[model samples]
Target: MEPIPNPSSAHPITEERPGEAPIFDWDWTETLAQSWETLLLILSTFWCILLARVVTQKLQLHDSPNLCYAVEFGLVILPCILLITVAVDYSNYIGFVMFSGTLWFLRKNRVLERARTRGQFDLGGNRHMALSVLRALTHLITAINILAIDFGSYYRPYRKSLQFGAKLMDTGIGLFVFTMAMVSRRTHNWSDLRRIAVYSVLPLILLGLARSATVLVLGYGQDIHEYGQHLNAFFTLVFTKFFGALLNILARKDLHLLPLGFGILLIHQFGLSFLGVSDYVMNDDVDRTNFFNANREGLVSLPGFVGLYGLSIYVNRWMVASSLLSYSELVRKLRRLLLVVLLLWSLFVISAYGIGISRMTCNLGYVIWMLAIGSTSLWASFGAIDFVINSVMPWESSPSDEQEKGLVTRGTVAKGGDKSIVSFTISQALNQNGLTFFVVANVLNGAVNKFLRPEDRSNCESVIILLVYMFLGTRMAYELLKRGIRLA
Candidate 1:
């Protein structure tokens, strides 16, 4: 094999190897590639159908006791599968295709109109809950699939998967909203359902099983054989440096988790940076063991790293405060903090982009990804602001003409002589579904960045930056929540 080019020193931009061109046709030589594409499409669609059915059933059984089951499946199972599958292959394109197809079906059936008129409620008046479940499920699945597939690795397959998955998720969500609109129009008084249907129970159970199986079947051997040594070392370090601090926090109630979390994060950053720099220095020859090469190798292995990080954060946080605060309070504060951090982060990221574009040999794709992160952050920040504002503001009274037209205007007078401000406000905020999108988008961005960027910096630097931003963001979020709660 030809010697690996030195990334630090002068290196020529290499030409593509034969058959490595982006638009290779599906001939005998590329049959395996084509087959993989086909398999992904089929599997993704199957999963989509399963997801849609679960969502539909959840909405239908809104009053039932199994409501939480749907929520759990949507939030946990769907996202996990999405993450794993997206990492596996070109599943994202399949999702997009499926989503688009779903949309067309909904449009043809007039489902959208019905959904809008009904306020997207189910027949039993739990539209919001149902839609929330569905949206979460769809997004998680989509995001996971996207993460699994490398965009540039197999260009055509990756592109197709992304397109298909995007369309599929969008359509699934659209159908859900449309159904909800129709359901919301109906009026009924009902109790939450307590009965469980086989349809719901079986699917969720199977999905759970599948997710576990997938993790084990795909991850077990690789984790043990390939990454076992390094992973064990990393975990040991994490335990000594981070987990120990976390346990102390748990034992001492007075201890603050955030500071501990931040400190651990900083340590992680330092460690990663040292490793990256040391690896670079040791591999002075123009070999595949250089800093950039090591970085790429680490990047490719980041999902496991991030999973550990998430676990560390959760364990630390949960140990200190059983219930940190109420969801409402959390949401309120998180929203405000998100807005401020997003603004600052956007500026910093933009500066990074300028540097990357002007000085570094970055491509259009890198620029685009950076821009997307900025855009999504801005969108999510604004969404949180909008939710907070609407929640606090009094609703405007509807005109008599709107009343005559039987339209649910901004704020209508109720029989109790109180305006429907509270109801309207809460409804509007929930309907935006901003929180769901924000989480999904952030996760997706992280996954993309982990894979795409040139791994010049050490793990320490990356971890440090991540921790610093997260700490600042969380702190701001806490303050915002406190302020909002006080105002209320």
Candidate 2:
């Protein structure tokens, strides 16, 4: 789906909100109603998996440490596309059959066997967790995005889902930037930002300008700012990268610089509110729609997300420690990490209860919630999964250890590799070439929205069209990864 501008920091807070409208008629009720049977079936399928995991662990049914990574992607990600694209009417019987088969398609995702390496808690643990959640998030959005609507209405029960769903795409974008910046910090000097900015951000500006011009010149006025594909480009190229560069300067590669970035983000969040910035965006229809909307969204709403990038630096520091420790010592660090997550969650709860959720204005509450939820969930998930796997198979062998014994790193790996078969294809593809696929989605969306009649399409037709679009994107991603190319 095309990115909307500064679409108020995202999910739980934006239910049927008034400011933004969708590109198409998205009846939340209708969409959910039509899909509920299938939805319930999917949830049940997931439930069964969870139950099976518990059973396996309890009974020690499968001592295979690698079973931690087993999952049926064909069922989890594929059949949903198939069901939606062809508009197959949901039948409990058919769903049962399909989902049952999916249960049998388990494959290794190569998740971490240990939470720590040497003496420190491994940051790679979070990488695996984020990759899993992010891929699932990507796939869900890609599926629903076929209709090309934001589903931003707060009026629906799915308001929370809608908001988080939309927010996930950009959050993923910001998360990666922060993570890579942590990586880059170890390699590059501060002075390299200008060169990096030019190489990265400039292309986005040019592409955005080109897309905007196409909409303006060709009379494609619908969601013009968004359709032009500039919003994400601005966030990724400008705010995410450039702003990060400046912050990196201030951070001076010192871990102490993290608190500074965090402090600055807090100031930005609260200072703007005190200055009536939040009031203006929330109440001023004209300015909100203009400044906060697509055209110059980067101008108004990016600070919080940029600040998020800033905070990620501190988080990376927390996740990555100098001490290489034994497994028991790493568990101590995990306990402390869990404590930090609780504190963050407390902040989120206080902020939400105190100020209420508002995306229209990038309020302090919004900032706290996103940062707290995002960071906490990542760490907690990592810890939880690592704990479960380790407890289940204390002697599990990883790829490195297995290789010493001449075993394959990944079992019976396919041509497209683990990414294609392990998790959802769309996310695997998007992860491989997020920027390129994003550009492709925008260009293709603009064309389809301009030329095609979404309103007249049957449900099955919409599903098929979206599936086709996602497939092409996936193919492009596979090819790009195979060739070792990426715009990002």
Candidate 3:
């Protein structure tokens, strides 16, 4: 085996010394460690969904979404960051809070009885509560972890280990791609390609170029291993979107996406396994002199992510179809979703044992790992929405009207002064323009890193800094939603 290269040496322009960059220098944990961490994240996520319902629906708490934004900041985003940061050491305490909080709301409100009698509240196929919550949390967690990973309170295990195994931050880029695919509308006609390019691809390319330029100019500490010498998160997103758009136009039907996606994955994995592609990407001794070698991680990983994008489009098609089914049929479809999650997890385990998980290469194990996590999160969020939250706060809309329009405004106030069932929520706000929100968070992360040395801070200081940063970051999304803006 070739000797491993210093992760920092590839980015000699950064101010960081050899092997001392706070974010880049870390040995990752075994895959088994991710299970416990994932459980806590899921638990906190479920609790956030429940609490959002109880506060906005049951209690009629929306005097103004503006005033209530702080309530969300404290209840939903705060505990979540705390669970992963300052409060991480107290797993039992945090776990009890998440468990008891979710249980208390469920039992105290009598979810089952309400669900049985509340009648059906259809918000159409696309604006699903379960999927909405999942998408929101994806943005929330990704935003938090980017900045949190620099702090002393942030555990090393949660950072992107790069070399092997799965970590929370490691899953961020793939989840973003998957979530974007879930809502991607099928494009028809080459004429639409220009609009897609201008609206979608252009922004991502600009963001990628901007980030790459800023990092080099500011001499920010970078982990070249994460995306190679020049490529960053934005470029990965750009390529994913660009390629996915071409696929959508060429396929011309949702039905074609599933099988085609699977075929792509199989072929990609074959090359990695048999063609020695994985060996080349993982070899640290390789020099980063050419564009391909310099950005090999970003380029090689594109196929896996594009395949994931195709697969997610199929999953979204399934969900849209499932939403139109009768209650019993919907339940069965949901059960099937659970089974899909199980199958993905099994595949992930098999792949991990066979080739090991590597985010750098976006190898078979990494792709399956992403699918398993994304599917499980979607399942849990959907289960909560369908079984509990939907019944807890029913939408008062006629069945015929819902069927005809197949849409409901997210921030609509219920008629007859009934408590606003679908009032403004942090998740709803963030979902308005998720990509823009992510960009704002990245800017703030860079700013914070420039002024503060989080690696040297105490737990209390770190938590306070993170909370302040989160507030400022979320505020942009929330305020933009208030102004009826959607920057994609």
Candidate 4:
């Protein structure tokens, strides 16, 4: 998923010409009053975790671990379900509570608590499962946001009553990808870098070139994206993310990665500005509307995203470099996280007010704003959720406890985790299997567009279609799991 999609960005949706020019509203990113609801939602999400956790822990007389897991999962997932179903203004609030709470809950048991202080992050309880669950949730939410709406109108989306808020998938992907990357850190060696390059980056680059050729040569995506920028997200992963890691490995300077990347970005920004590629020359409607793959957007924006990728490494290094032993220790760590958030927020405010917020250029202000908001939300949401999970379920249930209670047995997953249709059924399907679902989803979406043509369908029909697609994807994941198949 390319972050901050332009109206005309590549991604096949039912095409409908607008009577009037479509408006791109971004006031909430600037004004405090307009953005008040979102800020409050962030707070409300954290509060939801606290209240749910505390209440659940206090009423834990059920004396059944399975019952407790079921109850906890329900309490956390309910708000998210409401948000996704209703859409509109409430989406961000519930989405935040859901992901952030689950993230914290997962972090309750540290796999490498002592190593964390020395700059290592090893989480307990089937990390692959955790990552899969989060990615699946992200994909699921994005699917609902895009597919379940009316294709008649970009905003209206035929029959849907509420529009999804921007804050949902726009920022969610960044956090999860970074979380995934951070968990799998420490491959600065050349052999490992080359292995990733051959196995992942090169394949992605080729896929991107093929996708780009669909537009540039065959004229598939000529309506929305430009020839150059029409290359798919695989290009983003290969060029922006993997390219950065390759640079670090070549330089053999892992510690100084972000600073170096930032410097490179600064040079690119100024170089683009000097070459008439800046806002001065390309301020026209065609340029703004068809910003994808534009020379400025397609080429120049790479450094910005790469800078963000580099910064994620640095941020994750600091984040997982330490761990908590007690509630009081968590409180201290949280305060530190908040302090960093405040400082970053100050920088974001300065950048937005001083320069401006431009998603097109992947401007410095926009990047800072993303980090500031993402870090605070992740920290606060995760900490609170972890607290509650720890209170309800022991981080490591003893063999005796499991044997006596006949509960969720030790190390259920031989490779991943328990295959039972338990409390985390949907998440388990997705856990460590998000990519397969994503690829399946895209292929199926294209097939749907070809056959069903969602643009012609009514809103009710579209929603039903979306449900079918989702069910199909989930079933695919489940069957794969049963057969011990995985798409990493």
Q: TM-score for every candidate vs. truth? A: 0.29, 0.62, 0.87, 0.65
Model 3: residues >4 Å from true position, as ranges? 1-29, 100-113, 116-123, 397-424
Instruction: Go through the candidates in order and give each one's C-alpha lDDT.
Output: 0.31, 0.45, 0.71, 0.48
Candidate 1 on 1-488: residue-level lDDT in tens? 11322432212122335643221111222222333343344345334433433343334432222342334334334434432332334356546766676566556646434333321111112232222323333333434333332322212232221101111221221222222222221111111111111322233344334433444444422222111222322222222223233233343342343354345434543443344421232222324444444333233223223222332333223222222233344445445545644664454344333321110111121222222222332233222222322222213344544234322223322222332211221112223332333233344345335544413433344333333333332233223332332110
lDDT of 4 by residue, 283-399 (tens): 334454445425444455566666766766666665545443444555566678789899977876676455444434555655675577567655754453343333343233234
Cα deviation at 1, candidate 1, in Å, is: 30
Cα deviation in Å at residue 191, candidate 3? 2.9
Worst 10 residues of 1 by lDDT: 356-365
RMSD of each: 19.7, 9.6, 6.4, 9.1
Number of clashes in every candidate structure? 44, 13, 0, 9
Count steric clashes of candidate 3.
0
lDDT (C-alpha) at residue 384 in model 4: 38
Worst 10 residues of 3 by lDDT: 20-29
In terms of lDDT, model 4 sits at 0.48
lDDT of 3 by residue, 383-476 (tens): 6766666566554543333122322344234332643334436777777777788877877888888889878988889889988888887898
lDDT of 3 at 128: 67
Candidate 2 global lDDT: 0.45
- Top candidate when judged by TM-score against the true structure: 3
Error of 4 at 388 (Å): 2.0
